[model samples]
Target: MKFTTYLRQGAPRLAVVDGGDLIDLNDADAQVPADMRAALRAGADLQAAGRRAIQAGKRQALDGTKLAPLVPEPGKIICLGLNYYDHAKEGGREKPDYPWFFFRAASSLVAHGEAGWLPRVSSRFDYEAELAVVIGTAVPRHTTQADALGHVFGYACFNDMSVRDYQKRTPQWTIGKNFDRTGGFGPVLVTADELAPGATGLRIQSRLNGQVMQDANTDDMIFSVAETIALLAEVLTLEPGDVIVMGTPAGVGQARTPPVWMKAGDTIEIDIERVGLLSNPIANEAA
Candidate 1:
């Protein structure tokens, strides 16, 4: 089932997506938490709750609803760089043996339809369309690939926006990747049951102001979600609400002949077939 976190009275409220409407999960079942992160942590059968909500909950029109990040306050937000072969080649790098793991602070999260800030510090703002994995169960160190996916809860589209200058200033890409409100993170969350295992084979694309910029399939990723989870679990505990953003494909602004940076008033969209679409407007950070 598709789920979303929308704003009501300036507070985030979880809902199950229905035809042209949203069913308030908490309103349907007092047992269900209003927050996505809390619901994941609570370990309730969200799909079941969502189904119940869709059948007999408070219904509200979904059109033009303001949103919040899928997991508004994720426990951990891990990301990978150059996880796609074409993307690696475009950046003049060889295929990586291990995923270039990075962390994004919760503050970097921008909900779908929100403005993606173009920092005043530099003009190299760019976009990277990525697949976001939301952890459902704790994955302990040394978890095997076979068992890795079992811990995943759902998937969402993410725009891993970048400030290229800040990214290259240091060896670590976190500087540019962690800009507040740069990470576009929602629209809807599709439970793992609704898609292929590990969410492979789905088409992923990015469009800037109605023009396609990046296009690829999830199968193109060098590090599969299960593999990434196992590898990451080896380093640290992957808890509920922890997010793993599988890297982007080729066609990022920096790879173009004339780098295409996101400017104010531009709308950037990340669309993952079967998962969802995450769209955000570009705006000046200093404004």
Candidate 2:
């Protein structure tokens, strides 16, 4: 089942998307937990109960509600970089010996359709269209590839918007990637049972305005989702609701003939086949 968080009277609440409308999970008798983070912490029993209510059609869809980040405020937001051969090559680097990872603070996350602000600190803001895995279980060190996927809850489209200038300032990428409101994710979270975690062959593309900017397939990932998960699990514990942003394919603005950075009024549409489209507009942070 697809899940979403939306705004109602300036408050954020969880809901399940049913067909064209959204069923308010907050209205279910089970007392919709505080948020997705809380729901995940409640464990399988709570999630199962919520799913049953959604399937029973006991919820109501609100009118004129706004979409919030699918899993707003995750416990951790880990990201993979240079995991796409073409992206690595575009950055003038060789194939990585292992998955190169980084972290994005949960505060950086913005909802789909919300304005993604380009910070004035760096003028080289760029876009990265990626597939993000949402963890559903705690994975400890030394997990196998086969067991890696069992920890995933589902997938969603993520835009790892970057400030190339700031990113290259140091060997670490967190500085450039952690800018507030730069990590725009989710129109909805497609559950694992529906899409099968770690399954490749899905197409991912990004558009600036009406023109395609980035286009590729998950099959092109140098380190597949399962591999990345298995590798990360060896070091840190992967808990439910922790997010992993599998790096983007080639075709980013930074690699263009004369690097094309995003500006105010620009609209970025990240579409991942089977998952969904996540679109946001560009705006200056100072504005």
Candidate 3:
């Protein structure tokens, strides 16, 4: 089952997409009617109930309405860096022996179809199209690959936009990655059962202002989704509502000859096979 969060009158609510229209789960108390976050915290029971309710609902077609991030406000946003060999080589860095990780504050998340703000904080804004994993259960240190997947709730599309100038200057990538309204995530949360952890043949791509920037398949990932979960579980406790953004592929703006940074009015679209396209307009940050 696919789940989504959408804005209705400036408030975020959990919803399920049938064909086109979104089914307001909050309105129908037939199942676990809590919000997406709350339901995630409640674990499997609520997820099952929500799925059942969504399947039973009368399909409503949404005609080009805005979609909020699948997991709008996760407790944690763990991101992997240079997990792709091509991306690592492009950055003039050797492939890491282990998964290099960083964190993006929950405040940076922007929903699908929402406008992405180009902050005055930096001028080298860039885009990264990635596949993100959403955690479903609490997992402490030293978990096996099998144990790792047992903690996953679902998967979603993640666009980890960056500011190249700020990122390269500092050893830590948080500043460039955690800029407000830059991380685009959404379309919907596809349940773990709906997708095989590493077997899904998903193709991820990004287009900036009608020009294709990045194109790659999940199979090319240096670290598979299951491996990432297992590796992270060895150090940090993975909890429900925590999201992991697997690193992106090559063809980013910073890597281009004449760095094609985003400008106000530019449109960025990321498409992941199986997971629908997430498109957002670029706008100047508010004064």
Model 1: runs farther than 4 Å from truth?
Answer: none
Cα displacement (angstroms), candidate 3, residue 58, comes to 5.9
Better of 1 and 3 by lDDT: 1
lDDT of 2 by residue, 1-287 (tens): 77778877767777777766776665764565747767776664435655665677554553345777777888899999998888899889999998888999987888898999989777799999999888877888889899888888888999999988889899999999989989989988888878745848899999999789888889889998888988887888888788999999889999999988999899999999999999999999954
State the C-alpha lDDT per candidate: 0.93, 0.83, 0.81
lDDT of 2: 0.83
Per-model TM against the reference: 0.98, 0.94, 0.93
Per-residue lDDT over 1-287 for candidate 3, one digit per residue giving the tens place of the 0 to 100 score: 77788877877778777666677776665445446777767653645556665777544655576667778788889999998888888989888889789999878889888888898877788999988888888877988887778777778888898988888778888888988899999888777887766535789899998889998888878888888888887788888888899999888898889888988899999998887788888999878
| 10 residues in a row with least lDDT, candidate 1 | 54-63
Write candidate 1's Cα lDDT for 1-287 as tens digits.
Answer: 88899998999999999878999899899998899889888898898898888878888887799989989999899999999999999999999999998899999999988899989898899999999999988898999999999999899999999999999999988998998899999899889988999999999999999999999999999999999999997889999999999999999999998889999999999999988878899999955
| Candidate 1 TM-score versus the reference | 0.98
Per-residue lDDT, model 3, residue 158, is 86
- Tell me which of candidates 2 and 3 scores higher on lDDT: 2
